[model samples]
Target: MQSILKQKIIGIDFSDYSIELLCIEKGFWKPKIYAYSRCILPPGVLFDGAIQYPAALSGILKKMMLSAVPNFMKNGLCVFSLPDSQVFFHEFIMPAALGGKSLRQAILHEVRTKFPMKFDDLYYDFIVSGKNHDTQNILFFAAPDYILEKYIQTLLDAGLTPIAIDVESMSIGRSLLNSRDRRKDVLIADIGSRYTNIIVYNNYEVSGIHIIKEGGEKSTNRISEQLCIPKAEAEVIKKQIGLSFHGQESEVSEIVADDMKEIIREIKKIIQYYLHRKKITIDTIVLTGGCVLSPGVQKFFQSHFWQEVEVRNPFDKLRVQKNDEKNKRNVLFSNVIGLALRGLHTYPHLRGVNLLQKARSHS
Candidate 1:
């Protein structure tokens, strides 16, 4: 495929744990990493992935963006991915005859039957994937209207323009897999601060996501409780002494081992259920997020799953000129990087659906 000429855009993402920002100058081939930064938010600013204190969080975000990209106001182009909990997706078949105005009516019909909440409360969009005989398979994604409104308000207050609000799981798939990867079914384990999103990438669109309530912070807390250390110090020490205890009697090692296994178990259960009902078997396993940084985590995952497990660095594909060793090594920034890639719309990956198109036009 040919390359996109050029554009400038930034991708911003935030969780209960922190705020992340990334910018790219899309060019002939690989896009240059224009600027990037990640800043930890104050405790209690976010709870369960929702902003508990919008004004203060907005201030923190503004300061971080200013320091990283001083000229952000000039272009102000960006995409934001909200916390995964607020974003929901489902796949359903639509008859080919309902391809026009009736398609919207069909979607609304599915919404009324599937979603407990009223249709008026949702902000939704759909992307058609493939046609089977007279039917079409489309992925539907929606987030609460109030959730989008509050977050978009915060972005505006932070002095940025958001062109699209994205689905987190799709962002993860786009960042790791490209056109070549479209031939295989890839399973991605995106372990975040408080949740691990298990995403299944079928040929084109994201097949499904199963959010496990286990993540980096949770493991740190367990280590602190078992080792009698402060949570801050526990985080540092957990990274220092990972799953490879190598036949030691250390309780810290035992605690860490159990936590890792539990996460793996949950993921396996989800995969088994999918296998029973589908023809696709997982082709590869990709691990992302800070939680997977524990020394032997990737090795342990491979041992249990008996597959090729890799810690993916999204920057490896981009044309980054600067010597930002930290950015190249960190996997936590995959979501934002994918967001920026979608903003460019150059890559061979499917043009993932955006939830913010309506909101952007209204603004």
Candidate 2:
């Protein structure tokens, strides 16, 4: 049987504020980007990870897919990501003696007991890493059934096949971590328009994830309120000035500083929790998502964290076209590129957890 990992697929990321789509040709050494595009979502289309207007979203997606890639309709296989707020993650260790059906049963029982929601209302999946003596370490995710169905139905309405679904954190991890960095402990802070997703990766597997309800949108709103300007104008100024703390932008930067500090504090808490539980220090911190486009944000993180903090570019390894404008906005596509990388299967360690088969099995 042909492995699904080897198949060519498009990757889609649905955020509260925007939708990103990427299609790439999987190569042996590096993946080549064929096309990519981003579409801003109108307000009320998606809120807190739920699709409030499925038909409207589908219509927008249909237009985006048609315009972004020439052969999107013919090659409809796609893997998509759900927002971090809609997904729940947990890690546990089960007896290595359990195998196959027994392991599945054990995991299901544990998931049902540990998670507050009933199994019937949720779709869950897991990946087992290596064993430590007699116990196998496992990372699993559960998302509400209604949300999953909404995504699947939206894709269907857009004339695309939804092959698999994953969370944003996994996609970010795949896009940011290279082979050398996979085995090292790392922290990823993905600051999007409406949410900041903090993910911890230990020894090539996701160990922890947390979603902060603050992000670039909050910063923009602060800038707007402080400058007494319209939001659209504030957005432009925010990107142009961006926490530089100098000259004309200093006042705007100061206004957004509080939110940034809160985000950093949350990151610290997540790191401390991981360190206390695992006894391993995080080797590096990778920052991605739209907020990373802020002019001095990377330096801000580096100064505060006192660790090797770097902004992630999902397209760094891919072949670049001459004067490609999309390359400059790599941070915006990090999650979608990571989802596309999941399709390439160049790095098995970075492949995301696909819940499609698990969802079907439950049905």
Candidate 3:
């Protein structure tokens, strides 16, 4: 008998204190989510994006799988994300004369020499973002192989399989571009627990990506430490009060304002750099992930940057069942949703990289 084909794709979002899983099967346009699970990490299990308690995480994953998806379990390929801090992204210009085979060879050679770590020590990918008069601009991304291997092992220990590894920023970009028009340049900002990632796409290709060392969790930590309150309570206040409150003066508000200033400063620098390099103003700033949900976050950008900033809804143009409306509104699940949507044709060029790897292995 012919072996059963595995078409389902799973996405795991291992955040600071929670592990989220979104499993989906390809439909006509968007993916149909088959299973979704979120497990909060035990106290002291993980802190500030570091794995302080691997055993706890593994236990959580195992229990979640048993409870969430029982019958279809198989190793089950999953698309995993790497923290913004653990990865490096750079864009460089390639000689315009190097086209086709020559261009491919040059990129492979450069990846080996320019990377701080040995080629085998890191998983690297490159995207060509069109050519200038004498050079072709390319975006290069590298992440430690060991870090990714550990995540893969974590899944394995929990009886799951990791099939693809992607940068969180790119995954967010995938979801945004998939729902919106692809003909325009866009920027996607993924606000995670402790860090925010910015990815700029020109013509649907990654042109630039950067990570800033601030996010919702930082705001919560600052408030908790300054006010001497519990973390849970601080988080609640941060999300509820947000940055727009006009009453109740305290040190926590000052700290939050400082953090916002730093975040906005870096964002302006990155946006300016993109404008200079691309010679085109960004069409839209799409915010996703957990942090952007806070009240006035969109207003913060609008008042400061003078650009049209819109919160990204992964299901904005997609269809889902009536029961899934609430789940569909969670922007924090955008990366996982996009990862699952990889099974669709929305990201065909990304698939080309896998084929290129195969050809290299044969050669």
Candidate that would win on lDDT = 2
Off by over 4 Å in 1: 1-7, 69-75, 247-250, 321-323, 346-351, 358-363
Every model's TM-score: 0.89, 0.91, 0.85
- The sequence of per-residue lDDT tens digits that candidate 2 reaches over residues 1-363 is 154555567788887788888888856777787766679899999898899999999999888877785344334678898887888888779987877777878888887687677877777777775567788877778888898998899888888887778778888887888887866888999887778998888887777778888888887887888779999999898888788999876887876677788899989888888788778689899998877887888888888886699886778767766477877888887888888877666543234577665632211
Residues 187-241, candidate 1: write the lDDT tens digits: 8998876788889877855777788888777778988887788999998887777
Lowest-sum lDDT 10-residue window in model 2: 354-363
lDDT of 3 by residue, 108-204 (tens): 6776687655776767666667777888886666766666666767778887766556667777666677634467777787777778888887777
For residue 242, model 1's alpha carbon misses the true position, in angstroms, by: 1.8
Q: Candidate 3, which segments miss by more than 4 Å at Cα?
A: 1-5, 28-30, 43-55, 69-74, 96-105, 111-115, 132-134, 178-180, 249-254, 321-329, 345-363
For candidate 1, the lDDT comes to 0.75
List candidate 2 stretches off by more than 4 Å.
1-7, 69-75, 346-351, 359-363
lDDT at position 193, candidate 2:
78
TM-score ranking, best first: 2, 1, 3
In angstroms, the error of model 2 at 207 is 1.6
